[model samples]
Target: MSEYHLDIFMHIPKTGGMTLNEIFKKQYKLSEIYDHDSFQKKMMNMDELTEVEKRNIKAITGHYFYGIHQEFSRPFNYFTMLRDPVDRVISSYYFLRDYPGYEMVKDMTLEEFVVKGPEAPNLQTLMVCGSQEIPDIEIAKENLKTFSVVGVTELFNETLFCLKKEYAWGDIHYTRKNITKNRLAKDEVPSDLINLIKKYNALDIELYDLAKQLLNDKLQSLTEDEQNQLKKFNLEQSL
Candidate 1:
């Protein structure tokens, strides 16, 4: 890995990103990492950071889109986690309904939120493609190709193993964060509501399918010893 290269973690909300962010905290020094929520409170945007500030930082993590690399002059690689569109949308709705600064969605039912919630449709595509207008799957796929790692929430431990190997990271162990308690499982949702979510998130569904294939391909490429190591890691975590 190049010492000068920046590691940009594009954290898609409700995609097991919080857990990964905690792992990132263990990997880099406090001064070397730029956290989105931390800087947003200070009203600082990525583009506003000085050259010195940018150069000193090693990793950037937050609910940011893909185009943040434009702010830096040095080499950079992006890594992000994706989730099943239906589950992600459901988790997001329940989490945000009670979350602060989102009072507008407090009374909306799942169906209502599926139809009208802000940033509800094709969120993954929007984040990956960095498009504020219509989200384009082709653009998202092209951008995903450039990511050093693309992880799926369904295969989270595998994703972490990949990250550990890719970055030579230490202490890959972690506890889950930002979980939505009492949330309904995808199967628990009414069929009609599920279809509505699918209608709104068609692009995300497609993107997620592609991401899963990519992750599987990456896992398949691991050497035999590496596969055994991954199995051992999972077993240790389960114990």
Candidate 2:
């Protein structure tokens, strides 16, 4: 491992990443930060960057996945958050549907979206597996273990506490962003469609399970005082 001062935040879609971005912004200088969406016109291959550009970037974040780690000469620690597979798929579907010019999913019904949308199958697995076409579940799980922290979206407060401990992060504060406005309630979604989503995203479901286990283990390891501190922070964050 190269000795690196950098941190790579793998911002998986609809995984509470937008909220984390607020925390990152407070911690790192604007120039040191590289927001892939705004700063990078397209996802540039790691080889495309000059050494100077790489060195200047203290933190990097995007929807990209596992393989980018190979591009950095300096040592870097990675962290990411995973959400419940079903909810993540639903959120992604609704969010993209509304994006102007991304009309392909806009007209799709929830069932149709789960059945045919581009993001329907194993997205998180494919991302971490570092292949768009053929994802390897074992590889994704192993890659996850290498992260400084792998958090679960449902357990946001505890996840943030783990981040604070693992990376010595300060300002574990955030406000939500990129919310899917007027999303359907859980009771409104049909059971059959939900099953179809589960069947299609089996690999993502497995990967999410691994993330949950990792996060749960971390939380269990904390002292009672630390856990209480995290609760206090979460309360403050809510305000």
Candidate 3:
């Protein structure tokens, strides 16, 4: 019944993706969803899925790169949310410190983490470009065009409105998840550390700015009545 055979959610870390994942759980039956931790925990890679399993899957959500489309035989759509690089890096550092299996970062300073932490710089770009090495912004931008919707963490409500329209999803309401309460606010971080984050995430900063423009354009494309509906949605969420 859906337009695409499969819908892929590229869950970039520290980008408010967990909230979206929760909303996704409500939209699809557990059997229809292919989550990395749930349905495919034993598999080494997505390529291990049998043709029958792939065909039956309605949605796939995970911290995966953009190229997963190569593994599918049917038409698919990709959607993801990105965050400001500086804020994302800061959040990731603190969140990983407390997260199991990431004990390596427990004693690392923010500055050390920014310079050498895993998936630290231009992570959004890397995910989009599907490269572990230095990411290509142009390639990332080109790949972004194939996505059905691109959302930004800073414009979360607007992103939700777009997602609902794009997928005809029901009951988009959700509570936040995986929040890093111990992280320092961006303003509270020292100037040198802020600059250090920027220095390493320059490409991400550019990519995020472009994503914001794309999201804004999508918001502006809504009809007057639809715009009013989005406004009402925002108002309701605020309260």
Candidate 4:
């Protein structure tokens, strides 16, 4: 791993990142953390910043590609969450349909959105792969391996547990946010659409599976007490 002056949260869209953002905010000082909006705005002016100014930023969270790391002068740790591709695409479709800026998908049917949206396919893989064009799968896998934390949205609690152990972060508590509205239940979505999602996001499905296995492996390594602690945290969040 590279020596890092800060941690970068490469937030994948509609992957429970909104909730994680809240959790991360509590773990770092206000002066040390930049939320997504602020981070992007700051990046535009980064070239003018001195080394000390850049080093002062302890953490940055945003929806951005891997190459953002190149903009920084010092090394930084990366973290991100991956989601089940089918579910993620479904969520993204609905989320963008209503979002003010995404007029392109505003009136699109789910099918149309999946087929036509510029960022609808293999987005998770694209983000990590660090390219606008077709991404290299091996590079994406290697990039994820270098992350200080690579989490899965489906296994969010376990991911939190992994982060707690890996970084000794404070209070892993989180409440869900940015849930897609009127989402069809997995069983409710038609098989044809599901297949289409799979076809469009094949790489994301592979990446998601990799993340799941990695998370499961990390969970397996936890001591009984650590597992119990995570359980306790889950139980607390439920109430």
**Stretches of candidate 3 above 4 Å error?**
1-4, 40-48
Residue-wise lDDT of candidate 4 within 1-239, one digit each (tens)? Answer: 32266788899998999888888777776657667656424544445555765676678788888977787767788889999888888888878877888988877888987887856889999999998888677789999888877899988888887887887787777768878888776778999999998998888988888888777888888899998998898888789
Per-prediction TM-score: 0.96, 0.91, 0.95, 0.91
Top-TM-score candidate index: 1
Q: lDDT tens digits, residues 32-67, model 1?
A: 888984542365667677777778888889988888
> Tens-digit lDDT track for model 3 on 88-190?
9999999999888999999999999999997798899999999878799999998887788999999998999999999989988777898889789999999
Runs in model 2 lying further than 4 Å from the true structure: 1-3, 37-49
Clashing pairs in 3: none
lDDT of each: 0.90, 0.82, 0.88, 0.81
- On a 0 to 100 scale, what is the lDDT of residue 99 in model 1? 89
In Å, residue 202's CA in model 1 sits off its true spot by 0.7
lDDT of 4 at 102: 92
Most lDDT-accurate candidate: 1
Clashes per candidate, residues 3 or more apart or on different chains: 0, 0, 0, 0
Clashing pairs in 1: none
